[model samples]
Target: MSDTYAGAPAKPGTVSARISPVGGLDVLSRNEVARLRGASGSGLHALLRRCALAVLTSGNISDDPRAILEQYPDFDIQVLQQDRGMKIELSNAPAQAFVDGQIIRGINELLVAVVRDIVYVSTQLEQVGFDLDASAALTQSVFEILRNARILKPQVDPNLVVCWGGHSISRQEYDYTKLVGYQLGLRGLDICTGCGPGAMKGPMKGATISHAKQRRRHNRYIGITEPGIIAAESPNPIVNHLVIMPDIEKRLEAFVRLGHGIIVFPGGVGTAEEILYLLGILLHPDNAGTPFPLIFTGPRQSAAYFEQIDRFLRLSLGDEVARHYQIIVDDPETVARTMIKGLEKVRHNRLDTKDAFFFNWALQIPLEFQLPFRPTHEAMRALQIHHERPRHELAADLRRAFSGIVAGNVKEEGVQAIEQHGPFVIDGDADIMRALDKLLQAFVEQHRMKLPGGTAYEPCYRVLNA
Candidate 1:
């Protein structure tokens, strides 16, 4: 593999270069190379290109998924099969990803991860015919994806904490996330997140300092994302281990299975979707005894954010739902200490139940939560957000509702759908709809729906009180 950079004359903000695989992936079968090189609509090339571009432009602030593509319209990547290994050829790539002509090592690694995951999911999982419909089968598929990425480790303690929050947030909220992460790192905890900017980057950034101070080695900064959301929320530079699940369902499932605990910072619809997904799973009768540490935390200014979230969860899922998590305000140290204790409980529960330390095998995730939810206009309107249903069931639908709003707000497909067919109409119980409207309005008022510098956020859905 030649380290010498060779490419055409650089464009204003883009470069064309051929870079060898750096990490996570190197060799691919002849069949895999063909599929990757296939540019037809049905082939994996489009998906690879989008994800790779996102990785190359890591730490970008924009949430508009299409914005990046429009910025680098000619950017393309091709996988060249070689006898020794695989070579990645880039055309019109983001200039920021390269340093002194050569691609940045971390960006190269993440690019490889994009290719690795896209190929693995398309060829190994889909072509080989995994039964993704069944709940257990879907769970197994998620495990296979993670295992293939080499994220799951054996004989490790339960120390992975998944942090969820919006990419668009205030500097104050971002700083708070960093403090919480620093405290977690001081306690020897690793960080996992959706792998975007703002809150996702903050904790990982904070932990790096604390980990260095503590002389910690082999610390993992894992970033788990899926194809649809990757362009909107590129993986931050702090992420050393990046895994791209096929879709959002598997992405969320991977988080629950891999992380021992979860910390939610102030966020909008995306974060609410995550909270609802976890709460729905935890509320399942079978998972009642399982110990999963979940905390809602933010700075003092963001307390009202958590309060609104708490109220929404209680009103929609029931007051008992509050027991699943605790609220910590402006106190990063206490949050970390609480997480440490919660992790101890998780460790003991794993041992007592004879479960794997790296993966939560005992938790029961129903088929509803495991299935991928496409947020088309018709599908979004059909969601049943009534209170009379079982709490967990209602939580599942509520999660779907938020998931739709997230898609509409950022995901390329969802945004197009909303453009074509106005806002999604969410019809549910009168009280729940009112509460949902108020919460969503707060998110908009707080500039949580989209990054502050971008265009003003338009309502993607209408709440219909029934």
Candidate 2:
């Protein structure tokens, strides 16, 4: 509990405890039980270990998620289904998560989240009936995952705000996000984010104070993440409702569909990728008339940051794309007011359109956006970033370019590829590639690419002029 600026690194701990799986997760199929039991290659144990460790080390500082694994290479998680409930046994878990003997309650809940989502996705939802390849069906699958996690609320009146931003952001930018979150919470809105540090965690932290002051009960600090990038950016301790989506695409889709409104804070490649994903869908001819409220906000110090982002969007997707979002800086109250007003419109629009308030059933997310992009060397080179295609289609490619950059920066497979092969080669229209290169460089120069004080940000992909 000492808020010392620096302290000796806490040595790791080992614990044995029995925790009942929350929300009937204990009733998992025997096959699901066996998969969690696997600690080796054939079973889903490796995925379970990485995710469990990430939760146990919630406030992790290093962006190279592999760092912890390498440090505690023998760390293992086991699921024991007894006659009573479920017990999660952890060996070589991080010591920071425990005070005396028992694990922190919040960390325990998050650990359960790791097992819950991993089991659900691996066992039930990925079956042939899920039809993951079908665009509309895939969107439904996102709803199913969220619903199964009990995230989609039936009686809510549009108060969930999904906050998007980079894990590595400036101190000033991070503070600005708190102000925005405070304002939103004061107005009775819940906050959701990618569940990492920096911009993603700041709002939730800010909102907690406001919600406490307002005596708001049942305030949800929802954190939605996928395992691939999660180790690099562990969940911020504030996240109470954590759901791990199967992959990045489904993760993004879950955010858009589950929340009533979205606010983009100043960020790096990951943030840019999210912006492009929404822009692409918003610009789609079928979705042009939807009433989703989107805003880009930051503190006054972040004006230059926004300017850089705005320039990139206009340059890459054309000036008309500006119509999809508004940039409000330095004012949390206005950001809150704007979101409230916008969500009112969202509610009315949903009622009039007969769309479910829990999920945006009407949003037309095409197959290209739904399917996961591997960001392999060949795939990065194959992206179609140009001016001639429809703006939405162009946004998808731009999204892929950013996605590849994000992968190269943090995801496990992406990092290993960069180590084995050199940086990924991204070929695109001359002007677009130049702009992309410049923006990525700024991220590194500002130390927005990786957690501060870690190794210098390494370029993960090379941009080629078309």
Models 1 onward score TM values of: 0.98, 0.95
How would you encode candidate 1's per-residue C-alpha lDDT over 259-318 as one tens digit per residue? 999999999899999999999999999898788999999999998889889988888888
Sliding window of 10 residues with minimal summed lDDT for model 2: 1-10
Q: Clashes in model 1: which pairs?
A: none
Q: What's model 1's lDDT at 180?
A: 97
The C-alpha stretches of model 1 lying farther than 4 A from their native spots are 1-8, 39-41
Q: CA lDDT, every prediction?
A: 0.91, 0.85
For candidate 2, write residues 136-229 as lDDT tens digits: 8888778878887878888789899999998888888889899899999999999999999999899999999999999999989999999898
Name the best candidate (by lDDT).
1
Model 1 lDDT, full chain set = 0.91
lDDT of 2 at 452: 82
Which pairs clash (backbone N, Cα, C closer than 3 Å) in model 2?
A: none
